[model samples]
Target: MIISWWKETKSIKEVFVVFCRVVALLLILIFALVGLVELFVYLGIAQDGFIIQRD
Candidate 1:
């Protein structure tokens, strides 16, 4: 029974690692998209009428 329990525990840890990897990947993708948007605005590629003008 002890050996079986150890196997189960290992399996659970493996599943947890996979879950973490997937979540990390999703977060990285989200950050990459945000960075791309920021780059566009920084480079003046996303001009809109909302840009305020002053005398």
Candidate 2:
């Protein structure tokens, strides 16, 4: 009974680790995309002149 419990606990831990890794990867991807978009905007690659007149 103890051995079975230990195995079950280990399996749960492994699954939790995998889930954390997947979440980390997704966050990294999201940040990278945001950075790229910001870079483009900074370099004027995204701005097509739509004048916002002074209010």
Candidate 3:
């Protein structure tokens, strides 16, 4: 279904442009998520690695 839709609707250039846009958005989202995680860790509200407890 998707293949047929693509074949009928968009040209190669249009498909390439769409693919680039999707990739760019994905990269932006990944960076934003990583930045937020780093910010949380920097604020001491989160931690990295394993935590150990001793009695």
Candidate 4:
């Protein structure tokens, strides 16, 4: 992966494949973080209205 960043790609497809993988991983991380935060709020372990308001 480090080599990809420095090395030239033979085709645009290679660049896009790497780019898509990185994007997918980032999205997964973001959604995981959001899910964990929501779980915390649901459990009352987190402060209400600080992260989200409870009704």
User: How do the candidates rank by TM-score, highest first?
Assistant: 4, 3, 2, 1
Clashing pairs in 4: none
* Tens-place lDDT digits, model 3, residues 1-55: 3543665646777667767777899999989877787777778876742132224
Once model 4 is optimally superposed onto the true structure by TM-score, how far is the C-alpha of residue 48 displaced, in angstroms? 2.8
List runs of model 1 lying over 4 Å from the truth: 1-10, 47-55
Give one digit per residue, the lDDT tens place, for model 1 in 22-50.
Answer: 68999999898777766776788964322
Off by over 4 Å in 4: 1-3, 6-8, 49-55
Report the number of backbone clashes for model 3: 0
Worst 10 residues of 3 by lDDT: 46-55
Error of 4 at 43 (Å): 0.7
Ranking by lDDT: 4, 3, 2, 1
Question: Considering TM-score, which of the candidate structures 1 and 2 is the better prediction for this target?
Answer: 2
> Backbone clashes per model, in order?
0, 0, 0, 0
Error of 2 at 1 (Å): 24
lDDT of 4 at 47: 69
